[model samples]
Target: MKSEHTETPVTVLGLGRMGSALAGALLAAGHPTTVWNRTPGKADALVARGALRADTVADAVTASDLLVVCVLDHAAVTALLQPVAGQLAGRTLVNLTSGSPEQARETAAWAAGHGIAYLDGGIMTTPEGVGLPTSMILYSGSPEALAAHRGTLAVLGDPIDLGADAGLASLYDAGLLGLMWSVFGGWLHATALVGADGVAAGTFTPVALRWLTTVGGFLDRYAGQIDAGHYPGDDATIDVQLAAVEHLLHAGRERGVDGRLPEFHRELMAKAVAEGNGGDSYARLVDAFRRP
Candidate 1:
């Protein structure tokens, strides 16, 4: 019996870590993958794994109807593709580079001008996570193109279709990064605090992670309050939260932990309460963040 899968010709422009992983995943999934990179050497591993190495960007674009560009940034992607825009006509280009929402919109407009269907994507997984089912990728762009190449794209994991708006993928990426940074910052603060008690990070990590799971529920509740713009002090008011934050700051100082982070929270809450938001929900601090 014939195989159910249909092979698609995919061109991966930029053979950096992420780019190489993408091409390798395509090749592994039995697609014909064409790879091109400025350095040339970066394509060797993919070539060995059955990828066709393109000598020029134009050659890469012309070799495949579905092109995946995972360059350093929007500027690099633009610089590389601008010179070979003619060859990209009648093709679908999926850009997985990290960039601002404005950049994704601009690139979509440019691709449209060249008669190319554009899909802006954001990969949340590391290079090793490519092709794994656990990997998540945010995508927003031409629906027709996505439907046409969804199977080929699914090789990288679940391709989450946000919407037809090209900017949504980048916006999602930015929000996800903000969450990641907040978690990382909290982890660092917690680790340092435990260090003062002669505790190793390895010993404290599991406990901290358990606490994170508990706090995750709080985030779900806070999300509803934030979206509704309802600053109800049913749970805890700004004054009460500020009192707890001050206590945290005091403990941090006493233990010689990093005072800067806890102090910043305490100060922010203090200002919010002083500005007559003492009875408001902690989420009301979103207003302070918006202030200059």
Candidate 2:
């Protein structure tokens, strides 16, 4: 006898890599999965794995109370769901498509108008990372919907409820991606800097990772300073880091490694020093990133 919780019927629309991964995770968790893709043949593998294939978007929407959509864009999502909006009403629409915060908010409005339970999502992993307990799947909009479907959604990844703002998931997604690229640029620059001295990246990376843990602690401490709008210089000040950036730039130049990434850091620190905020903690530079 299948318990009500164990037999969640989920309809996944769009068989793109991420969408397929979502359906596969659900199926592996013993959910009754129905999948549909415009190409039709895209669902072949999932169907073979015992997923039911819906021939049309309408059929897919009607097949399950929980609907997950991952497609090309918000525009593509609109094109596919608008015609079947009637069928979508009263069901949970978990949209994992990539788009701007505004787009997510617009979709949430449209869903609300139709009485559809909406959750705008940001998948914090590649398709390969799907179903991993550590991978985060951010959700915002409709707290009740998240509470109801959190279990079924956990099959995809760790479901992180981000309150009831539909736009927050997308907002955080863009910011987080920006943070990732910054870290990548810094790491790559450091790797090249050391590699210039005949040091292998593999040898340096493990040590670099440990440094990141210390940096993470810095971030945790700085977050409070930023929120309080009072960046205390009791810890290391921006002026101190500015001197360290000079050393990094000198080292990069001597080794013929590009100094652009560290140069940006130097520029920010120098600006703070010139503005007489150099005595403040490194987080004082957060003001440089904000509007006047």
Candidate 3:
């Protein structure tokens, strides 16, 4: 059934957790949502909630000019869409599959070859976070397509346009996930070290959050320093932090906590210092990560 008011008709081609969340958000926001899944059973709940269930992938693709695909991987995306490539011409295909930058670029090229308007997307939150205002959904490809469907897409989350390179969405997603893991590792390590002295996690986390805000400011400054290839030590010197890390190692040793994370940091800082960067800011360590 079509929406009487003609809300931008949309189809979601997967029924996994994240895909279901996306369809739910679109329906919740008044879109005429069509859904399809291989198992058929997966679409039952969505159908009960007023989503039109497409009997086949072709039906789903034909149901809307804007199709959102959130599938298992690049291979699965290929398998699902290749047969229907002809039907997809001139339509906007928003692929939210997780894959490498190269894969995304290749898919964009394939879409371009078929005369389809393609937009590669990265969902920046868990299934539970979908549709929340704070969640960011990154999109890159076919700026014209995004400009046209942005309002409809915003129902899924904040649509962050990363410009026309379809691969940039995947690249940014991978880097962002890496940043998340690094933050998690550092937070867990600190929690364990503090817990050793009987500090409750709940008590320590608020302070840690405030500290992270301050650290975020440092990152803002350091990003520019890195781009300029001139890391100033006006705020704090790598040599000073090098001396401070010894205390952390000592504390971790006394508490029987794992010291590998801090040890790695110490190694990086020491190398920078050895290379005559001791007077530079910690941002100089960015060079340590790069190959000559």
Candidate 4:
């Protein structure tokens, strides 16, 4: 049986790991895919998988009305696509390049000037995760373009529309990456602490994951408190956490685990206590992160 979205032809410019994965997903979903890479050899595997290899950027751009570019950076995206601006008019260009929000806005403007429909994208998964429905691929700018190609794009991942702000996808991408790193750091620190007691990471991780699920519920509650500009300490107060953090510090110190991470938390909580905000919820710490 044929897939419903297979009719939209896709031109993929750039055949890096993620780009190759994107093209592979589109092809696997039965879309007619044309692929190109600066190093021509990169397209060989994709071509073998039934993707049409485009000899030049212009050929790639003209191959399909839905053009997806995943390149090294914003500069590379601009360098590759600027020359083919004439061919892109009336076509939709989806850029999955990693770049700043400012660069995304600039690219959206450039596309606008050329009459090209644009969607700035942030792929939330690594190359291996591409095409899985569980993976999220964020998109912003040109709601019409997103609406038109969403079915085809879904083959890459779950398409998350971040509204019409061209810069939002990149902004959210940066924030989400920072959150991932923070989670990784905390997990590693906890694993090391437990490892000192002869606990295997595998054994501790399942329990840690359950704890994270509980933490997620706290976040949902805290978000409401934050937005309301009120931090009720009904559940747990900063003063209580301040006292609890010292235990973590002592444990890390006794175990000879690096104490910097917990120390940072201690410092933040201590500062809030010193400022007479000890009765406030942990969400009150958001103030410490705001620009002074």
Candidate 5:
């Protein structure tokens, strides 16, 4: 039976791991995909998978009205697209390249000058996670462009629209990566502490995951406190958390485990208490992170 949805033609301008995954997802969704890579041989597997291989960037850009570029960096994106700028007018360009928010805004401006529709994107998953609906792909800029191609883009992942700011996708991407690393550091530290008592990481991780789910609830509550700039200590005060952190520090020291992670928390909590905010909610420590 023929599907009711029509496939949107897609052009992928890079064949790196992430780019190849993007093209592969589109092709799997039955979209006509044209792909090009700086190193031609990189497109071999994709070509074999029914993607049309483009001999040049220009050919790739002109192959479809919906163009996606995922290259090394912002410089590479600019270098590759500048020559094809004239051909991109009236077409939508979705850049999945990792870059700074400033670079995203700059690219958006460049696209606007050339009459090209632009969407800056941040792929929240690794190459292997590309086609999973659970994976999130954040996008900003050109709301119209996003609405127009959202169905095609959904094949890569769940599309999260951040509106027309253009720089928000990269900004949020950077913040999320920082959060991920912080979570990793805390998890590894906890795993080591438990392992010292002969607990296997495998055994401890499930418990840790449940604890994280509880922590997520705390975050949801704290987010409201943060936005309102009023953190009540009804649930848990900074003073209470500060005292609890000492146990973690002492436990780490006794186990010969690194104390740096807990030490940072201790420092933050201690400072908040010293400043007479001890009775405030732990979310009050957000002040510690603000620019002085």
Candidate 6:
């Protein structure tokens, strides 16, 4: 039988940077937390802050109806919890480990097989962002389980219920990271280009930040068009964009700036155009990713 929560006591597994932040947030929110880390010494700070240090994984999971696991990966989480599967029969397992969508779905199935209600999560914020309303944590899994611990989960961050599809959180996490890398890649290239003219990154930081903020609105507008498969060149066509990219490539080469970054953009734009999308919006290039 599953254990019933009478006082909202919570269990935290893994005491890494993110895990410690989560446990600290819970303690600050006045929830009695039971903590267990593979390395016994890692729980010292939480122990000093009134969290009960569990001697074993079983004991930790047994201590609370809501068990939060934030390990390194799916394999580590599986190994750590395999020994305590029996104890998790009725417990709600919220996994905040970063992994692929397939891993999340497989773990969800394993949890269901053990009669555990599972929720997969992706923390979009850093450790310092925990407990703040702005800290967005995407979650997907059993609705009932989420509803049961919504209050407790909110103590860590904003609990966004994506859906019953356990893989959604991880999918969103991967997609967000791809977007982040794209932005970062552009920034690094821009900084390098300006640095060639003896301009420090600090001097160009505000300009880059302002431009990124303004361009962010394109994501929302393009999302609709991308989903609908409508590649209308309402704002800018791929051909026009490709022309601009060519000028960038030429300028980077002339200025002796590393042309690798701009070359990549030029190649992508050229490929999209060659694929008969020259008249379409730049957003239409996203389809190329699905070609495989």
lDDT of each: 0.90, 0.94, 0.95, 0.95, 0.95, 0.91
Q: For residues 1-292, write the lDDT of model 2, one tens digit per residue.
A: 5453567899999999999999999888889999999999999999999999998899999999999999999999999999999999999999999999999999999999999999999999999999999999999999999999898899899998899999999999999999999999999999999999888999999999999999999999999999999988998999899998989999999999988889888888899999999999999989889943
Clashing pairs for predicted structure model 6, backbone only: none
RMSD of each: 1.9, 1.4, 1.8, 1.2, 1.2, 3.4
List TM-scores for all candidates, in order: 0.93, 0.97, 0.98, 0.98, 0.98, 0.94
Q: After superposition, which runs of candidate 2 have C-alpha atoms over 4 Å from their true positions?
A: 1-5
Q: Residue 167 in candidate 3 has what lDDT?
A: 98
Candidate 3 deviant stretches above 4 angstroms? 1-4
Clashes of each: 0, 0, 0, 0, 0, 0
lDDT, residue 228, candidate 2:
98
Better of 5 and 6 by lDDT: 5
Model 6 global lDDT (CA atoms, 0 to 1): 0.91
Query: What TM-score does candidate 5 get on C-alpha atoms?
Result: 0.98
Model 5 Cα RMSD, 1 decimal = 1.2
lDDT comparing candidate 5 with the true structure: 0.95
What is the Å distance of residue 131 in model 1 from its true position?
1.7
lDDT of 3 by residue, 1-292 (tens): 6453677999999999999999999988878899998889999998998999999999999999999999899999999999999999989999998999999999999999999999999999999999998999999999999999999999899999999999999999999999999999999999999999999999999999999999999999999999999988999999999999999999999999999999999999999999999999999998878953
